[model samples]
Target: MKPAGQTHTLAVVGASTLLGKEILEVLKERAFPVARIFTAGGAETAPDLPVLDLGDSYQDDVLVEEPEDSEPDYVFLADRLRPAPEGTNLGLLHSAERLAEAEHSKVIDLGGFMLPKAGGAVRIPSLEREGRAPERLDSPATSYYVAPHPAVVVIARLLLGLSERFAVESAVGEVFGSASEIGPRAIAELQKQTLNLLSFQKIPQAVFGAQMAFNLLPRLGRGRTQPGEPAPLERRIRDELRDYMGGHVPLPALRFVQAPVFHSLAVSLYVRTREPAPLAALGEALAAPGVRLRRISEGPPSPVEVTGSSDILVDALTADPAHPEGFWIWAVADNLRLAAVNAVEIAESLKSGGP
Candidate 1:
């Protein structure tokens, strides 16, 4: 299926971090048929891609994807990987399960350090397709494709499209996070602590060990919560919203702060409902189909107006005046342009599932 306007041959592998240059500017703002891009890393000098050839061990570019003179049908793991690494992919992604033995290699982990693996399968092709249960890059399954965490793809596709008409009985949120999501060294220490506290100077927290400028750090450098493990970014966003909302939706109650602004992402949802749904039926279930909802006279969608939007720009739409079924959902997502458009839309659904 990798045919729409061009052909394919991609690879970005930690390409000199900063979300590997925002996954090459979201794969050239989603034109991704990737006719040849290959920018490998590690000691990284590798960045001249016009059909490759910076070769000569691009500073040991981690075995340049099994080099048969440039091989990368799809590889985008944009930097920051370290959960377990021993025998190389030097610029990381052997992050675990040896990336399921790279069968014809298809690893799209936009580096959530091996995307929520409490036993795999957390895909979200805008919420699965083909007879169900997300498995079709020609069925066999698991050639590695992580990408699901842009706040669990904006809370699992806005609570699985509002649980197909108000079935979600609970959800409480507050994920703010922004300093360009810690990359250019926590955005150069949040612009050097907002210019050393607006020129008074001295606030140089060794890259967010604290004082994340203007601070909302509920736990940006957390130093507590040790008994009964769950508070490390709300237990990894409730185990990635139940591994991509599979239990048919339920667990929410989240709260991952640390925002001083640099890129997008400002969710605040509070939904609750099992029956009687209102407030224009939860604003038409948060404007369902691949979502876009931003009215209420357009006032509350920030993160600098969802920077380079790939939509999730919802605004403060309130409703629980006394819980007639309760509601409220404000959002803003561009977190690395929705994790580089969900890793080039899951490598264009595995290159359009074509054999």
Candidate 2:
């Protein structure tokens, strides 16, 4: 096992993406023991990190060939879209098997392609319920580590806290998303469309397929959920939630939405507890390490408030008038930052012990 201060090199696939950039930022912000940085999928080169082109002719290799001394100790797959667009990281992470075969490097995927042969279960470092054992990285059962979906991170942290107090029966809510969830191109297109709309110019229908600027969508970009399959984003949350919570509670009625913001998620959730609890008792449950309850004086929580912050900001909480056991909770999280932080947290979790 690696010592805590022993520096490790990280190869960030899709380094040009929003989540990719955020991962780099979080790594530095937390002062992780990063010996060096390597980036993929960008035209302009970053100052310190060397670039690796994942071209079409790029050999399908897991141990990314680099200077022997600078070989990545771990890889962070942050591109949200799979089969990365042409000229992007040479489509790295398209197959998890190649990564698993790497003799030296460990792979931790944020959110992208499905892993090889069932992949590993989703992990939310913050709400690792019931003192569960950390998912072993070298276990044959785990092809790679998946960072828990950010929206689910928010829901899990908050709802589970309440469950510890009230035994939450069910939760129903819509998670509002931002362009950042779709990566850099989506953000750029949204910005372009917004400016064009204000200038009376023709809006670009690319990226999101429809005008996403100042608009909301049930789902965004390409890909569709097949029959009996949950929508891509929705499935991740549902599956991960179950994996973490087990059969202790029923899955929430949740839907993923694409909102017109650049970053952060505004989740509207209504939760029903097993027994009636006063508003004060339920409100107390919102106070957890990664969760911060909003102050009534601070106005409603929005993306602007959480744009660069680490914590998942939640506020606008109110108990249902008739059913005192049911409460409304609104949450906003910097999606990229939350996911990036969790990725690093998962890495830290590994340091405690790993094969």
Tens digit of lDDT per residue, candidate 2, span 289-323? 76788767788888867877788888847888998
Q: How many residue pairs clash in each candidate at the backbone level?
A: 0, 1
Give the per-residue lDDT of model 1 (tens digit) for 75-113: 777764344333434222434454445446677776555
Kindly report which residue stretches of model 1 are placed more than 4 angstroms away from their true locations once superposed. 1-10, 18-62, 65-71, 75-123, 129-152, 167-175, 180-182, 191-212, 216-266, 270-321, 328-355
TM-score of structure candidate 2:
0.81
TM-score of each: 0.35, 0.81
Candidate whose TM-score is highest:
2
Per-residue lDDT of 56 in model 1: 21
Per-model lDDT:
0.65, 0.69
Which portions of model 2 show Cα errors greater than 4 Å? 1-5, 42-71, 80-95, 112-114, 129-143, 221-223, 226-230
